[model samples]
Target: MFLLKVFFLLLQVVTVAVYSRADIPPPPEPEPIEIIELPLPPVASAVEGSCTSGTGCILQHAGLVQGGSFLPDGNHVIARVNYTGAPAAPDPASVYTGDQIILVKADGSSFSNGSPFKCITCGVPQDSSQGKTEALDYPQAFRDGRRILAGTNIIDCGEFDLVSDECTPESTFIHPIRWNTAVDGSGEGGSIRELRLHPDNLHIGFNSFTYDAGKLNQYAYTGRLALNSAPTTGLPMAPRYDLTNVNVLSNNDTRNIPLIVDRDQIRINTDAITVGEFRGFSGSGKEATYIGYPRESSNIDVFAVDLATGDVRRLTSHPEYCDPIDISADDEWMAIMDTRGSNRQMFMAGMRNVPPLTDIISTTATSSTRNNGQRRFFQPYLLDHYGDRDDYYGQQVNAAGDGSPGSINDPQWNGMADPRFSLDVTRLVYWQALVVSPACGGENPLPCPNSTEPGGRTERLMVAHFTSRQPVPVTDIEPLSDTISWGTPYEPGTVPSRELFISGGVYTLYGTANGSAQVTIVENGDAIETVAVTYESYSDDGLTFLDGTENITVRNPTVTLNEVDWYSDLTQRGQTNATKKTSPDGFHLSIDVNTNIFNANGTLSTTVNGTLYTQPANGT
Candidate 1:
């Protein structure tokens, strides 16, 4: 009789819809934001471009794939290159010898000019005066994947023959890792950024940036790395590497929450696991991925929490600009590094659910436009742990959006920061650079193209191979029999195609590669096995947790693993401005199930929340 009624707010009243520094929401009247079209994710690419060396088609090239990791015999990749053409000992101009730490042969196999790569920090005192300055930036491979932690150094140059993946830079040495920070000796020191190493290979998860009071703090730590028997009391002679039990994953604390409908109106949760920045962990380390805080306005997404259970999961939701990520080792899938299609933050996340106001104060001038300086408009998507809902946005590992200058999705060839996943998840290792000069060559009206790769070198090295093992989200009547898609974007992070579970009982809960839209698991009506979610509470008990601006998977999902997707912008009953071709018209999907705090050690979460309401008609 009312024709329409919809409201899914976590409280826009006293202001608790998220966007921090404290809270911001005040500018709305300007309007023009609406880019949304983003596509390319079903899977196709096989080898991809920009993998220079001699240009022989199958990986085995070197120099241009900085920062990579994925070696437990899934072929190979442990990069951090520099070498921009200068072999015969030529340009000792301290080009830093291009900051070596090589080895790339992502198993496409079949090449041999005598160098598939094997130069651990290349030429360091390892021999022949081949030293100019070894810089090694983001390497990671330990768990006997053959030693390495990079940038607190710790490398091992020989005897690493994973069946000739090769190694032996004449015995290199670059140890450095003594960061005390304060064990109580008055404290005075700091410096660390994105250095993760915790798959229990002995704890470690870093990221620090201090300045408190004057503001500018972005912490997220977890420590345990000791090798000191002596010598690090202040660096006697630089004995190196010592940090113990540090812990700080949610001590910035700030909860208040109380408005399920003006229960008096409170809402503060501030930032516990709702994290504003801290991106690493979760290969089963239990979950900690971060960068969330501006859920609507500035939009920058990517979240994942649940280190023992503070549970939150919002992993990337378009809005352009996603920060490098990885998560796949029997945990479903994810490989992020997005800028969507480089429409770059779409003015301020393309007006989706609106209400972020000036982001209060510009949110860093609107997330620094994703990149213009450090060059990173990013491009590398591959989701499915229930991330990116409704129309299903994922699958662009390098489909060659082809801006051409060097291919492989080359939008200027950006994309960097920890894009790894290999230990049988198939393969996906990354690196790319090439916008060049002061941000863009010469006179800078936006020139810089030139280097078409054969060592003309600006940065390259990417490997994407596929097979299939995570896609299953059916219902075209009963569609999902297998689903497994062949991998692409660029290729090689194998397990090529997947999408299983969900049939007789139904509990399926995901379906949108093209099948339209589906999200099941309703019980008495059908489908059931498990579904206990608590992701930062909205409370309804029994367990299903997800509402308001809802984030649909990018990674960090666990009720055991994946399935909490809910996009809900709801509003269409004769629509006003045609919200995405007539969104739900009056849709309220709460599907209740979840009961108070599950694990800070309390241990208890088993999900089944249900209560669906759909009224389609208007745009359809």
Candidate 2:
């Protein structure tokens, strides 16, 4: 049943309406609430483990576990391993054989190795330091129990047979399209990175770079491969780009790396492909907009192509580097990492005038033409800077004093990367780096000499709630305050009393707990409805609700309570306290809650049309 759920989630597709800035709705006004501080739960001890010489060496280093994902049940975690080294010995031979695919039981008591998925023609270099054999990077398991693996030179699909609980050799597809021998030394040899599986699971997309002679070329292609293909037959032919009217071949002069298609955008019957094209290299000497690269050559601009119709449209024309990171699930907004400024920042722009499938596929053109007089499609609003600290550079000290730390010794903020939206499009998560001082030996101010210095740097996972506008650190342990609630009142003028019909409004709550929690809605000291709430993990977070949790909503609930005494679990530790205010005209209900427990003494303004109620047990 769990496997079936995973399979359906992979195949699920959704579409959202694109809107212009003028058509976009304004964000909801913030709610009002008072917070009472409580002691945080005891921080749990670190999960302790040690790798003895040869037995546990693989788990010792930093980059060994490059990327991973858990199965639905979370009893197993599948990951791509790139062995670096251990503290005792820099590079251990037993572990550093090459890049390996591995599956470990969640508790670390057992593990299964899936390595030597050998490339048919690719040769293993005699030199051990050249890096792992084929150097596989990202490995992901599909819902059907198949694992898709990517490396510098090849991509492999490992088929898992449920009966034997093993990946059979014949079921694997080892494709060398990205690492052809003719291309390897011909200066045309390229590496495939950022491999993404399309929604259909049959098609895969990725960015590949090849340097031939004096010119450098980048291409993005989605190819068709069957799950049951014979391993001895070699991988399928390279995906054809020209067939889709994506001219990576003819326009070799310009760098035309395809922007990754948002997985959400690849649904049943969708033909549009989003990509980034370097405009200045057209050889036509057109005016360049992005200034990140040489002024003589512009940086990359985002464009969308219709595979079915061959129609192409420019989506953004920012003067600075505005690269598409990911599109929102609804396709209404696009999240981009804007590098126009000194520090990398996250921004969102309304997706406007997106061409339909019929319009995109039916149009015929040898090349995409710029939409003349079209307003720059991307009018990005700044979300947040990738790094919190503004005092120092990301690495090594320089004479310019850019790397000097301020008095606080705050974590040196590195640029943000891999910004992705939640499936619901209400939250965003990204990776952040901070250089911290090691306890023993390091620079006085820290993060100065360099991140390579004794202590090294710390990578932090961060998340932001679009509606809440607050950035929170993602901790290994679950949040103490797991649930938050907001409510609205109905028929304001119909009743003169402070009581309002909350039953007419939907009540939504967000949580970070792993299992189910009982949500009891109360009215006038009586429990009206007690519903069991189950929490699901987001993609950015692991199977556990350690990152940011999911949101659950109760619609049209049957309950009416005084605005002052609505929430039932206010006195419960780690539970949220909320208050609702109606506008003077009685048209809208403004609900607010003290969401963060760290700022317990926080107070809300009482001048609105609602009374502030305090719990006698825990005096405010």
Candidate 3:
């Protein structure tokens, strides 16, 4: 599916409407609970090679559903399952038990080369004492598929053994602890929870941290590796999620959180190892934060983290929101999904500080265009497909640097959002789930569903077309039942070149041989002049007057010369006239000249050299 559509869905979850009016009811509050840190479970063997290491995966019929996501490398993909909950479990012939995270290549190729993407049971090992229904619902088998960071759920808490690649019943997933348990002082207040991890997956995001779920706190606390002793003050929150954005720099004593906030007013929960905390995050993976109506105003802040000093230096501060920001394999250009206006257009910004040259590429599902008095503008807007299917709103709002559109006559974005250049970003070669509203496109916008039971829709890969510049339409036509997506361009420099002409002609070299004379000419030369010459010659064949008068400068003319040398011979052919010119002086004649002496030049000129022309022998 298209990358823009998937981003729209992610924004939806964060931008749930909360009316500020007193007459309106407050947003639903998260339930409260306890805070208990559990030790990671022991590793279990794969039943003596029962788990054959698969080479690849092939997906039959699956597509983007919701909570769309891509792999760390942006090459592999993980999407929400399209099929709803499986039939009541405990049946003798059930293919799956708990939630299964479907893994597939962006092209739907299988790990074993030819086989389709097969599902793996991630359910935790069931306890025999527990009923069969409960046995099938193991935590290990329930793959969240959405918030996968470093191959684990973002919410699963605690530090697991980084050595073995084995997962067990005790293996924690993303944010494994219930939200209520993360509260600090009993009853209801939220705690500054820290989700730390050994930095193995740096590509997904350098280090990420979000404020507590319920409240927008004044302080944003993060844990990082430091040389100083643990914090003596502030709320103490331990690592409660499996997927950590902070890197355990040098045994967790010195870690780094690459965050960029307007002010250093945020707090760091030094009690636990947290990487970094930024006010905004948007670019794919990196540090992304989208908070608004549908969370469309997300931004990714790039910064450097000092493991020892805990210093943060801002690397990128482009006001536009970019998703899946990536440096080219060469690291010259950085590719990102710039959600500057209504569309999640792909853009590339120069790392240098000279204003950052940027180019827009595609439009997100929620992108919009607008009209001013005499001019028109496009701001960040989304199709409101909430509640009723047809209730889609296409209002335009400026996603200004302050995270809000200021005015309709926003001249700062005159030609800024115009998609005139190709994006410099490249997507991973993996397929992920992409959600689309019916208001945007009816039925399947990318892949056509087969209407079959499980294998209904064709798997849609989320490829980043980093080089493409054209706006790929998200039309739900045939073949694509409902799932429709476009890949970023793989070939760069595909932008069509405008044609201009300089008056010119085709040039060719020519060589000519006449009797004992030969000449060569370069049909085209840089000289701007044309010259013509006439020459006389004698032939030993007694045909001296043959075509004696010919134009020297004819179009594509071929000039030849034949100089003859007659020898005194007394022999006769059919009774020779021996009496008249007997003993006539045997004259030696030769033509030594350069072919370039006579050349033609229209608007341009060419030269023909005759240094090779020779007349050695004529008669015996």
Best candidate, TM-score-wise?
2
- How would you encode candidate 2's per-residue C-alpha lDDT over 324-378 as one tens digit per residue? 2444433443445443332111111011111111111111110111100110112
Runs in model 2 deviating more than 4 A are 1-50, 53-81, 84-133, 138-145, 152-193, 208-213, 227-301, 309-324, 328-335, 338-417, 420-429, 433-620
- Cα RMSD, model 1: 21.2
Model 2 RMSD in Å is 25.6
Q: TM-score of the candidate numbered 3?
A: 0.30
Q: Tell me each candidate's TM-score.
A: 0.34, 0.37, 0.30
> For candidate 2, which ten residues in a row score worst on lDDT?
1-10
Give the alpha carbon lDDT tens digit for every residue of 1-620 in model 1. 00000011111112222334243223222112111111101111123322233312221233344657866676667776544433233433222344556555565453253545455565555332221223356778865666677766666544665334355444444555545554443232355556777666566676655432232335456666765544535542343456654554443122312111122222223232434456677676666676655555556677776555354667666767677688875556788888787665553355444333223222332344455555567877788665666456777867744456666765777777778877666667777767666556564556677766653556665766554433233212211111111101111111111111122221112211111112222222222222221122122222222222322211112221112222333221111121211133321111111211111111111111121212211111
Q: Rank the candidates by TM-score, best first.
A: 2, 1, 3
Q: What is the C-alpha lDDT profile of model 3 across 1-620, one tens digit per residue?
A: 11011111111121112222353333222222111111111111223222122321212322232222333333234333322223333532133322344444444344453433333224434331111111111011112222243222232222432111233324533322212222132332122232222122222222212222221112122232221112222222332221112221212121211111123121111122222232222122122222111111112333322233333333333323332222222222332333344222111111111100000001111121111111122222311111101122222222223432212223222211111111122332222221212211344233322222123332232233333332332222111111101111111112111111111222211111112211111123321111111112212233221111111111111112112222211111211111101113332222211111111111111111211111111110
RMSD of each: 21.2, 25.6, 33.7
